[model samples]
Target: MTHPQIIARCHPALEALLPKPTAARAALPDWLRAMPSEAPAETLNGDPVRTLKHCPPFLDALSLGILIPLATDLHFDKGAVSWDWDPPALPDTLISRSPIALHLPEQATGAPYPLAVNSILKFLNFWTLEAPSGTSLLFTHPLNREELPFRTLSGVVDCDLFRDGYVHFPALWLDRDFTGTLPAGTPIAQVIPLPRSAPPELTVTTMTEAQITANRALQTDLATTPGTYRKRFRH
Candidate 1:
């Protein structure tokens, strides 16, 4: 099926520095790219929840949205921060003038939040994300990316009407002691475009006897066959 497109726009100065966002499903790891293992090897200390929920396809699809990467290397030393633009950029350029602007806690958080820290700051990565006439852009942290030192707050923007405006990512600093180089091209946010139509009405009811029997039979088949879901069920 043909789907709508999500366009990424940037300043002329950043045309060469920052490439457009890429498809998240492309160039996935071998384990995810490969077919489901018929006789999968279990780890010595594997959690059942992880084993079940953290399947290759599941994790891959969660990350199968879109990714926006950083344009320059960022370094945080003690209280001083610096931005090192990769090549093309002059050394004398103002490092303090950050492309990723900072938003005050009050600006991000509507009401007076009662956090212990008095000076809470968030980094707002710049991106002009646009979608079709009736769609909005949904932003969130990349799935299974625990190594990153920050967490992007989830948000949705009505990009269809607000396409001209830039959508900035508000991220909380999770690791304070992280004083290394955050290399350029490191993905800072994952975005998904969703239609803004009215959602389907909720209908709750008891399962029919036939459905119950079918579900039980399917459960039994899954219990007996290792690749029942992957081979027989999944399209």
Candidate 2:
């Protein structure tokens, strides 16, 4: 099968200095790597059951697409944020020197974010992404990255049509007490390119006799088999 290509463009001078976007699989979190596939647990029969480490869907969601990493190390102390990145001199004056930006409290006055921080922070993306002609890019917080101190706001952009400009990510600072460095290579966003075709119409109906029978068989298999979905359903 042919795969669609996604391109990332940045200043030629900062090519080596900046952390390039990476595949989500290549950037799995440390906690995930340290987790065991199975641990001592109590099932109904007192047997050890599989953990999320052995779950394909959870792993697949974390490995879905490309991850856009922070270009520089971000330091947060008290309520202050700072970075220490010095990019090579470039002719383009439009590029941002700082790794982050801010949105005033008034800008998000009525927003329903869980956090009560006075301002919204944005990760400055220096790279421009280009997807296939008929696709858009879904930009969201890195999947299953709940350990991070902020929640990135989700957005969809017609990247195929809007590849000329940068797409910064806005996030709510969830931990005001978090004071440390978010390393330069930390993933800030996950980008998944999806086709622009409209989805099929929704249909609501009662299950047919065959469908009910199939559901019963599936349930029985799930109860009896350890890896039924992994062995037969997952591609």
The top-ranked prediction according to lDDT is 2
Q: What is the per-residue lDDT of model 2 for residues 1-235, given as tens digits with 9 covering 90 to 100?
A: 9887889998888788889999888889899989877777665466666789878899999999999999999999976888888887666658777789989878876877765467899999999999999999999999999998888899999999998889999998998877899998889999998999978899999999999999999999988988888999998
lDDT of 1 by residue, 127-211 (tens): 5778988998887877666677777777899988888776666676655555778777676778888888898899999989999
Candidate 2: which stretches are off by over 4 Å? 42-47
Model 2 C-alpha lDDT versus the unseen true structure = 0.89
Q: What C-alpha lDDT values do all the predictions have?
A: 0.66, 0.89
Best candidate, TM-score: 2
State the displacement of the C-alpha of residue 76, model 2, in Å, after optimal TM-score superposition: 0.9
Cα shift from native, residue 83, model 2 (Å): 1.5
How accurate locally is residue 35 in candidate 1, as Cα lDDT from 0 to 100?
A: 40
Which stretches of candidate 1 lie above 4 Å from their native place?
27-57, 78-80, 86-97, 106-126, 232-235
Q: Estimate each model's TM-score.
A: 0.75, 0.94
- Give candidate 1's TM-score: 0.75
TM-score of 2: 0.94
